[model samples]
Target chain A: MKKILTIAALALSFMFLTACDSMDSPSPLDTRASDTSGELNPDGLPGDATMGADSGLQDRGLNSINGFDPENINPEDIVYTIYFGFDQYAVGSSERDKVKSAADFFAQNPDMKIVLVGHTDWYGTEEYNMLLSDKRCRAVSDYMGNIGTDPSRIEIIARGEAGATMDVAKNSPEAKKDRRVDIVKVK
Target chain B: MIRRVFLGLFAGIICTSALFAEDAGTIRKDAGRLNVPIYRVAITSSDADTANLAKRAFGTHGSFRLSAPSQAQFIFDFAPSGGNSVKLTIKGGTVYEQVFSGSNSVEALMKACDAAVMKTIRTPGYFAGKIVFSYSKNGGQTSEICTSDMVFRNVRALTRDGNDSLMPHFSPDGSKIIYTGYYRTGFMDLLLIDLNTNTRKVFAAYKGSNTGGSFSPDGTRVATILTSTGNAEVWTASANGGGFKRITNTSATESTPSFSPDGRTLIFAGDYRGAPQIYTAPATGGKPSVVRTNISGYCSEPVWNKVNPDLIAFTIAQGKGFQIAVYNFRTKQTKVVSRGASTSGPKWLNDGRHIICTKSNGANRQLYIIDTETDSQKPLHTTSFGSAKEPDFAYTAR
Candidate 1:
């Protein structure tokens, strides 16, 4: 009787051991890392982390801005309002003071170049808007040249009325502010 | 005796299980490279699985197999099948029937299938050619002078220093190209560039816009649209840019000039009748004559075929889109080459079998070569996502 009981016990232990072995074995799918970011991460786990440590990886692998973060930009670069009258590209008295301040900043930094991007309100066809925008840009470029700035250092771009005139009414203050030039410094 | 019987039963059970396990494993074909599912079915005389059927349904089309209980799976290795849609019927663990259906004709389908199997078939060698044109890359708004492929591949910015380059004309031999580049100092000059050598030379430094250049058949003189006296007109000069003479006196915008096969007459796009139309004039000085009439909606860019000068192809804005229409000077009848909603910039190949034109999907433009005989069109290049405008074909460079 003891012999029979021993045999049965051995068989049961064998079956249990086989089941445990099967459960402990790693799956083939688990060998590959999860693609949660939807990007083809060729180097796989720990290698990717080390390579991307210097720069935080953007969603599309774009390099993150080092020091000049858009969120942490200085308040001086943001000009809230610039007013222009109908069919006019000349700087008014109030806007001239602002432009002078911009010019002073550009003059202090000799190596810096300025980009004058002109815009117009939605009052004409696309072709005419492009022409008007050119006129406005030329006016700003001429103004900078008269103020003793190098003509080659100043770049002019015309944006036309494509991005001007928000969903608000034309009589609104924001609408008037949209018809103007944006000055940006380029290094 | 009972112990021996138990031992025998255990051994028998293990052997049977081992056999079943071997049968359950996937059977591999092609030197164990391709693993296929094992199927079992009874085969009768009426439901016989022929080798051809096996080759057609699974092996030739894609990887498939047939097997019976305790037998190795049978694999058929046949030529690759063609066509987009395929139908197959399996009977008794084998493919008994097959049918193919697709947009391609039978001959084309067979050819495609043969190509897929051999992997050596290619489109005609000449189909991968390109045409160079002057385009505005930068410098103010209209500082044109750039070269692009027929389908706008590898768009290289040739001149970007704010000079206005216009009316690019290829040399007769197609080894060199000529154009008028206007400088900021108001000096209009004729610039010539050897395509192979990449050597540039300023031939003529004339006053006003020295535009609308065309190469003569014998490659001796270049017919150009010059506005010397404040009026746009046709002029000719030696290929080396000497002995310049005015050919016409028109206050209208006389631009886009081309030469006849014999280089005796010139066809240009102008607006003498209020709207832009095609007009022909003598290669020497003379009055212009209207070529086509009745139906008109801004027709321009008249390019004469090298083989047949009587057949002139130009672009016309018809319906909601622009189309390339050919005008037979003999019949005075116009026929549309491209059926797309937007097409322009018609240029003829040296053989005159096809004309390359710019086709647009309203948002982006691509280069398409249309066969003149059949009126069938195909994309020239496979890449590029921007607008490719103004194509001018030159002869295959020697």
Candidate 2:
């Protein structure tokens, strides 16, 4: 009985110490090197590399990068989607690369245009979904403009929960597939 | 005290056993509350096709019942007139006769028979009208707007945009259909299709979102929810998609704005207080008041009764499923009219007693007409169409 009591007291002390440790310092934010892959962060915000003092993509215009031949570039190969977090409209690190690519393509082919279709999952109010989708398009448009894509070349359409990527349950990881900006190429 | 306790226990047993009865209270006790005459109809025809078509049209009528000719108050008689036409006569205490033409096929004949039934009964007819709803294929990856007659015949595809097209609503006069269609450009634009002209145009493709377009009673303005102002708000603009103005501005998301019969007010679904509830505001735009009748859970997709202004039909979400419910203004009581199945998107027909709603079990969703007066439901039989939803009833054939 004495031994059992001693073990119980030690276990309680250890749990208390662990709880104090957790309360003393909360989990730090993500601090890894920013991903350079052309994709969006699940959190729908810019990565650490894109937020630093002077190395942000906003400072680098399309003219700074080597332009590509838009005519030779197959739309199926160059086309990519930029996903947003739930109810969010911010451009993340990965999506920034795709926007830069689109800007570069348009720079080489001035006559071409890129259409950004905004969509949302079947989760919120239909009206709110429309607005959410439009916000996503606006976020992409602003990013394109920041990178030197002509405003005339960027056309936005907001489809409110009409074109959902995943028809599964709402707010699930699969449903997030629907809340994205589908980038299509236009001549 | 012992004797009283025994009696109370015995009475509780009897009440609990009564709950086991099936189809109890299916037929409403106060049928006269609808103020529409109930007629028993008997159909007879020399042609097998005509007889079948007539039965299908009046089988689930809200104000009519199928009965034997001897007991029926009215009898419908059909005879083949010539190549693809029939003459119909309805005999009650008085005799009424008419010749219907261009009914070569079952589809055409059913429509003519439905029109004849309504004309004979002297009620505003909906049997010959059309319904526009959304249909999805490839596991809902792609959707299109489709319209069919009341019996789900003569279906026609309105938009072949190859993107996603849905939420087709007929105009007040049934001359046009307003819906949202996704273009290749990746955004949804409100498109209006003129049925009379076979022409379509983009109604509102605003910077943000232009959707939920509903016409006012006067047909001069359209009440819609737009995000051009950075938040979802109800707005009214010209029927031609000009003269745009904002109506509601709460931080909460507003959607599915339904104009009342008077066009003076609009009822919409919103999460005004953290949970979805129905709220009403002026059609011209102003502060909204919550419509808290008897519903306590989330309610959305509200539609006002066109003929009767006293009742509102909406879909209420309850524990993993939705049910069609109607709220009575006079009694302030909400009654669940659909039973044993999940339902959504209830729209009242012109009769004000029948409603078109989607009955689904998550796997297959089909449109079913629910007669609120009798608590009976009949599926809208669209041939070979696996799934259909979001039914909007039109009173006239435009």
Best by DockQ: 2
Report the number of the highest-lDDT candidate.
2
Q: Each model's interface RMSD (Å)?
A: 23.2, 20.5
Give per-residue CA lDDT, model 2, range B1-398, as digits (tens): 99999987886665433322222213335743444455677889887656655666677676667789997766778887777566777765335567666534544455566665455444455676678887664254556677776655456666544456667788888888888665432345566777786666667656456678788877777877766555567877788656777788776778788799999999888877755688899887789998885665678888888777888988786655678889877777788888766787888888777888887654455778898877778777632355677778776532
Residue-wise C-alpha lDDT for candidate 1, range B39-149, written one tens digit per residue = 232112121222222222112111123344245332112222444333323222223334434343222222222222212111122322346654431112343444543
Global local distance difference test of model 2? 0.66
DockQ of 2: 0.07
Write one digit per residue (lDDT tens) for candidate 1, span A77-159. Answer: 54323467754666777787767777777889888756565667754322233334545655666676788778767554445
List of chain A TM-scores, every candidate = 0.54, 0.55
> Which clashing pairs does model 1 show?
B135-B146
Q: Which ranges in model 2 have alpha carbons more than 4 Å from their true place?
A: A1-187, B1-40, B65-74, B80-86, B91-95, B100-122, B137-140, B361-364
Identify the runs in model 1 with alpha carbons over 4 angstroms from their true place: A1-187, B1-125, B128-130, B135-167, B180-190, B203-205, B361-363, B382-385
DockQ scores of all models, one per candidate: 0.02, 0.07
Model 2: iRMSD? 20.5
Q: For model 2 chain A, where is the 10-residue window of minimal lDDT?
A: A56-65
